[model samples]
Target: MTDLSARDIERANFAFSVYDFDGSGTVDAIYLGDLLRALNLNPTLAIVEKMGGTKKKNEKKLKIEDFLPIYSQVKKEKEVGSYEDFLECLKLYDKAEDGKMLSAELSHTLLSLGERLTDEECESILKECLDPEDEDGFVPYAPFLKRLIAGPPEEKPAEAK
Candidate 1:
């Protein structure tokens, strides 16, 4: 908790969501295998399975708390802050604890990012990506960020001669 910022907290939370692959609420070897592989930890499937059978009854199970230190280490090693850094920081919000982002959550966050967006523009962006008919009214964070990253850039008017 000392070194971990809100964004770091969000990143771990996102990974935790993915690690719960079976929707079992409790993670088994299968889930840990996938989680380890996603982070490129290089454990084989067989090893993963062995891990599943080895847990002690009185021991506590793995949680995001156990994962964050490794996540923190990885983040420190390769950090190159950019606009993505802002986005990384935005992970602290973005309804990201759920690993899905709501348009309403993003719109409020847009207002607070270093460069300001008018409420109109926030509403406009939401209209473009968020479907009014979707019952959950949320989008996956990766693609949602990709859409923003890959979309057209805003341009100011040309200067007068």
Candidate 2:
């Protein structure tokens, strides 16, 4: 936790709301895959194999702990931390003001991380994350961020702007 700031911890906690697959308040295997792939990691079958088969082959959830490895890697490579650093990283993935990102947003976010995704893959990702309402198809940011960092289910997280 030495590398993590209070804000970084908060950001990671907020990220868990959507990333947590089992609603267990703990990230598991599937969640790791999603976050890794979303961040543009190769996400090979071997990685899935390491999960003790608790996760399906194609599942997309992850244990929050799994993220520590990647975070460590990123920190080593890019020296990651700082409230501004966390904000910039999150902003790359958050497309709309509401702070929630569907699959498309995630794909674009990965792109910003230097990954390339096909249009078909992007479409598939959107299909996965989108709420299926809003003909214009925009994800709301505030509630999305709230889901990540909202205090005690009744309070708002501090506004990012």
Tell me the tens digit of each residue's lDDT in model 1 across 1-161.
Answer: 53778875775577677766556454443356556555544443345444442234324346566556545554454332345764576577655476566656677777875556898887777666444434776655555566655444558899999
Task: Please provide, for model 2 over 1-104, each residue's C-alpha lDDT reduced to its tens digit, 9 standing for 90 to 100.
Answer: 43766675566667666666557766655455465444433344444355332455444434556555554454344322334554555665555545544544
Q: For candidate 1, give the lDDT of residue 31.
A: 56
lDDT of each: 0.57, 0.50
Q: lDDT for model 1, on a 0 to 1 scale? A: 0.57
Model 2, runs deviating above 4 Å: 36-62, 78-161
Lowest summed-lDDT stretch of 10 residues in model 2?
Answer: 144-153
Model 1 steric clash total: 0
Error of 1 at 40 (Å): 33
Whose lDDT is greatest here?
1
